[model samples]
Target: MRRLPLAILAIALLVAGCDDAGASPAAQGSTAPAASAGGACQLLDFGMVNAKLGLDLSVAAGASLDNTFTCVLQAKGVSYPDLVLAVSSTTIDADVFGDMIQPKNATAVQGLGVAGYQMPTPAAGKAGPGVEVGWLAGNKRIIELSLRFAPGTPDQRAADAVPKVVELAKLIDLSSL
Candidate 1:
């Protein structure tokens, strides 16, 4: 339809602008650290995301392609509240994640993964009101979490940020991706 989510957000902003070349320490403004042990942002922690999405981020950046691995958390000299976690070890199913990564009217999350969904943030720029949660884990790898806020947050906080992005997507483990 709409050019497939704008061609998957233009190949995720051209693979996050080919990462490293962008000098990702949160892209030079500095602040990307944390996320070490087993990388890929260690499926997020940072004090359980500021005690459940009350966010203080404290930066953490990452990027990869050929098997996907993206982690970004923010808030150290501002850049709107941010939290993005992506993982993909290939192996997709459930009709290719409901016809290529769900999204169009998403809202089916029922037990974390093996096929789940959630939506919002289709527009709201300046990092206000957002929420997203995707799944397909049971080893079929494919996660995607999102949370944005900061810019007069409180539009019911994007429906209260959807169960806090399904409780951080049920503390994502998926064989410790």
Candidate 2:
């Protein structure tokens, strides 16, 4: 009879312990990363810099201007137009913004400096069919960094381009900019 009582007590303790184990950190009211105030931008860490950008997304109603930096390249007699790094209140869409540009198969990478921040190689690729787009995000923002290579360019050149984008992403200041 004593052994039966001890066994019952042990089972009770085990059940109590299981209840504690099932409680998640969130359920315990743990703190989460701080979200942006306007819910427009997110912060990102790309190994070298820290920054935030707009996501070009509108959550509720109003349309806002995209906050982005851009540069153009004219190499090897080709006009690579429409290179833009713009941030919106809701989305960060970086792309080669012009229509006359084409993806060049040549693997040429360049960097730009904006107000002391190095803009990452804007996500490079074609838009559709021959277009490519890349995106990265933080808890508070969505970053869509893209590029359009001059036609006849292979994707391999574009593969090496993402790190530059990561580098540039580090410069965004989501809290204020």
Candidate 3:
């Protein structure tokens, strides 16, 4: 439970420390702590996300570090409605996907990757209501997308984010990362 969030924070910090010079928002850079970091941002562009999530947004930043790639997308010139993506190395087995990878409240999802889960993110502090979709990709990799709405967004719209997040998750190609 607590392990997942800590792992994500560590990955994010590692990504932030890497250099992304000359890398366009779409490229996600080739620099990494180890190995050639592939084009992770290409997995889902703004158009793909906007079409599925019904929001106009742009890539704020993207970079890859170690075995993880991180991308952040958001509405132009605003911080609200931030969508963060992470594709990273994984060790979890599919057999324990539910019991180990996801919390008790998470819903099991299929077809997105080797195994998948979706869960609602409750608002806390400066963060707003959101939805998270996570899936296991090939080569022991996992992808997690967290989409957080504006704090004042209506309850229905926040609830609606669940399906949208799942749809956005499907756009990611498991073989690419």
Q: What is the C-alpha lDDT of each candidate?
A: 0.64, 0.27, 0.66
Put down candidate 3 lDDT per residue, 3-98, tens digits, no spaces: 366448744563344333432333233122111223355465666677788876653566666667776665544666877778777688776665
Error of 2 at 83 (Å): 2.5
Q: Name model 2 segments beyond 4 Å from true.
A: 1-78, 91-142, 173-177
Candidate 1 clash pair list: none
List the candidate numbers ranked by TM-score, top first. 3, 1, 2
Error of 3 at 71 (Å): 0.6
TM-score of each prediction: 0.34, 0.30, 0.77
> Which run of 10 residues does model 1 get worst, by summed lDDT?
19-28
Could you tell me the lDDT of residue 122 within candidate 3? 82
**Cα error, candidate 2, residue 103 (Å):** 21
Top-TM-score structure, candidate number: 3
* Residue range 43-98, candidate 1, lDDT tens digits: 66666766677666655666655677776666665656677777776665877787
Per-residue CA lDDT of model 2 for 6-99, tens digit only, reads 2223323322232212211111111232122111213322112112211111111111233322211111222231222323222222232111
Q: Which stretches of candidate 1 lie over 4 Å from their true place?
A: 1-38, 42-58, 61-72, 77-80, 88-91, 94-96, 99-104, 107-128, 131-140, 154-177
For each candidate in turn, give its C-alpha RMSD to the true structure in angstroms.
Answer: 14.2, 23.0, 5.5
